[model samples]
Target: MTVTSSERTLLDSIDAQEIVSLTTSLIDAGGENPGDTEEATAKVLAEHCRALGFDVRTVEVAPGRPNVFVSIGSAERPGVLFVGHSDVVPAGTGWTTDPFSAVVRDGRIVGRGACDMKGGLAAVVAAMAAVHRAGLADEHPMTLACLVDEEDTGLGIRAFVAESEQRNYTCCVVAEPTDLVTIVGCRGAANIEVEVRGRSAHAGQPRNGANAISAAARIIGIIEGSQAELDANPDPDLGPATWNVGTIAGGTGTSMVADRCVLAVDRRLLPGESAAGVVGDLRSRIESAELTGSGIDVDITISMEMPGFLTSVNHGLVTTAVQSVIDARFIPNGRSAGSTPAPNGRFAGSTPAEFTDIWTASCDGGFVAQQMGIDTVVLGPGEIENQAHRPDESLAVQQLTDSARAYALIATRIAALPGL
Candidate 1:
C-alpha cells in the first residue's frame, strides 16, 4: 500500500491540539453518571460530526442523557461501528486540580473523563472526520455510536444494540484505553447478592438463635474455596475466572444475635463461562451446606450480569486493527515531545507495539459482541492501569492523536473487506 500526500495531510490534521480542545470541552461539561446527563456533551460531539458531513442522530436513553449515533458513507454495504461512551464516573475526592478542568499541563490533559474515555471518544470522532476529509468515507460505510452510562449500567449500548440489530454492521471497534494495543477479549462481570436469614435472639443466649452471620461466614468460605479451584484452571489469554466478596452486612447491635446477613459478590467470568452456571453453582453450594438444611435460609440472587466477549485473532477486524496500530507508529512526530513517562512497566510514549491481551476489566464490548453477535475488538488510547478512575486522570496527547489515525485507517480497511 502506497501512502499518498493527501492521506498524510489528512492524518496529520488529527493533531493533539484539536483532540485536547475537544476533550477539554467534553471534560469541562462534567457528564457524570447517576445524576448528570450527556445531552450537552452529545451536542458538542454532534457538531463535529455534522461539520464533517456525517449524519448524526440523537436518541434519548434517559431524560437528559442521549446516545449520539453518526453515520458516514453508504449503508447498503456492510459497515464498521465505532463504540464509545461519553459518561464518566463521579470525580471523587483527593484531586489536586479540578476534575472537570480539562487543563493541558505537564503535557497531559487532566480531567475526570480525559482518559476513561472522553479522550478515546474524541479520537474516534476525529478519526471519522479525518477519514471523510481524506475521501475514505466513500470507500466504505462507517458508524460512530457514542453511548451513555458505560461507567454504570450500560443502557446506552444495550439500547443501541437492541434497536440497531437490523443494521449491516460486520464488526465493532471499541476505543477503551488499551494503551494503543489491540485487545482480543475481555472478562465479563456479574453482580451477585446473597442473603442468609435466621431468627434473632438475645446475645446472652447464643445457642438460642441459628446465627445468620455464621451461615454467611460459611457461605463466604464456600465461595473462597470455589474461587481457588477456579483460579487453578486459568484461561491462556484471560488469566482466570474470579469472584470477590465485595460487601457483607449483618447484625444490628452487639447485644443481639444477627438475624439476617447479606453479601454482595463481584464475579468476573471468563469468555466461555455462563452467568447462570456460575450463579447456579454458588446456589447449590449454599443449599448443600448442612446449616442451610438446619433451619438457616440461604437465598441467592443475581443483581446484574454482563457477558464476556472474545474475537478470534484470525478475524478480519482483529488483523486490521493490529496492522492499524503498527501503521500508527510511523506517523512523523505525531506524539508530544516528552509527553508520556513510562509508568508501571508499560510504555508511556506513543511509540506503537504489538501488545494485544484480554483486558482484565469489563467494558461494553461484552454487550456488543455477546449480545449483538458482532465481532468486537477493544482498541484505544491511554494506559488503563494508571489513568482510569485515578486522581488527576490524564490522557497523553500523542496517544489520542495516534489512536484517531489508527481508527481512521482501520475503518477504511475494514470497509473494503468482503462482507461477513
Candidate 2:
C-alpha cells in the first residue's frame, strides 16, 4: 500500500528524540528483577501517560514492584491493550559501557535494559503520544499495561488480569523485541527441583552408606538420554520440549560420602501440555530411577510454572496486525511489508519475507493469553540475539523509531475494528 499524506503525518508525529530520551531515562532507573524493583520506572511511565491526558493507575504487585496501567478508552467499551515488562534481569558482570548509562553511540542505545525492553516500553509510550496527538484516542479505545517480574516471577500480569475481570480488551500486543517480526505464540516454562537423599558415611567406610551424588548422576543421565525421544514429537509451531539442569549442588567434603543432592531443572513446555502433568511425569521418572538403584530417597517439586499459548494465523487480531504491518511500510526502510511463512516453517507473520511464529523461549505473553483469554501477539524492536540479558545490551536507533510508528499504526487500526 502507498503511503497516504495523513498516515505519513501520523508517523512523522513520533519524535525520535522523545523515544530515545524516554528509553534512556527508563534505562537509568534501576528495574533489576531480584536486586532492584520497577517502582520508580512505573511512576515515570504513569506520569508520562497522565501528561498525555490518559487515565493512569499504579498497582503494587509486590513490595517495591508495581504495575502501571494506562487507558484512553471508556471502561464500558472493548479496547486494545499493549503489554510491556518494566522489570529486567540482573546485570551480571562484563560490560564495556556503564550498565545504566543509556549511552547513545554509533546509532545504538546501550544499557542493561535498552533492548530487553526499556526500548520497547519507550516505543509504546511514544506510540501512545502519537495516537493522542492525531486524535485517534477519541475514535478508538486502547490501554497500556506495564508489568513487573517478567524476568522472574510474573505476579504483575497475574494481578493485572485478576483486577481487570470487568474490563474488555480485543487483543494484547506484547513488546518483547521480536526484531520486527510478530510472535503468535511462545513455549511455556516450568522450573523443577529434583532432590536425592542418602545416608552420609565416613570416607574410610564408603561401603556403609549410599552416595546421593551417584544417584543424582544417574538421574541426570536419564534426563539427557530422553532428549532425543522428546525432540521426536514436535509441535507445529514451537517444535519440541526441552530440558536442562540449570544448577546442581550437594555434599560437604571429599572426605565424607555425600548425603543429599539437589538439581535445579529448567523445562520448556509446548502448547497443550499442562504444567502439573509435566511435573508429575518428571517425578515419576525420578521414582523409577530410585527403584532401580540403591534405596536412595528421591523427590521432585515444581518451583514455578508459566503456561504456553498459541493463536492461529487466521485469528482476527493476527489478520489485522498483518495489515497494520503493511501500512507501516509507508515509512519504508527497504524491508518488505507482506506476510509469508517464516524460514523455520513453524509460523507466519506480516514481514515481506518472514512469517510470524512461536517464540522458542518463554514470555509473559504466554501467561496473558492463557490467563486473560485475550488474543495476544508479541511484536516490537531489537533482536533477542542482539542484546537481551547480555552485557552491552542495546537497541538500534532505526528500530526504535520504526517500532514506535508500527505500534501507533497497530493501535489506531485495531481500534477502528467493528465491535472490538
Measured over all alpha carbons after superposition, the RMSD of each candidate to the real structure, in angstroms, is: 3.7, 3.2
List per-prediction Cα lDDT, in the order shown: 0.81, 0.80
Lowest lDDT block of 10, candidate 1: 336-345
Candidate 2 global TM-score? 0.90
> Model 2 over residues 225-275: C-alpha lDDT tens digits?
667778888886778888899999999999898999999998888877876
Off by over 4 Å in 2: 1-5, 164-166, 290-295, 329-353, 415-420
Worst 10 residues of 2 by lDDT: 343-352
**Residue 357 in candidate 1 has what lDDT?**
68
* Alpha carbon lDDT at 204, candidate 1: 99
Find the number of clashing residue pairs for candidate 1.
0
Residue 84 lDDT, candidate 2, scale 0-100: 90
lDDT of 2: 0.80
**Candidate 2, 96: how far from true, in Å?**
3.1
Predicted structure 1: lDDT: 0.81
Candidate 1's C-alpha runs over 4 A off are: 1-6, 164-166, 331-354, 418-420
- Candidate topping lDDT: 1
Q: Who wins the TM-score comparison? A: 1
lDDT per residue for candidate 1 within 123-225, as digits (tens), equals 8888877777767675667888899888887888778878944457889988889888788898999988889998888999978887899889989999999
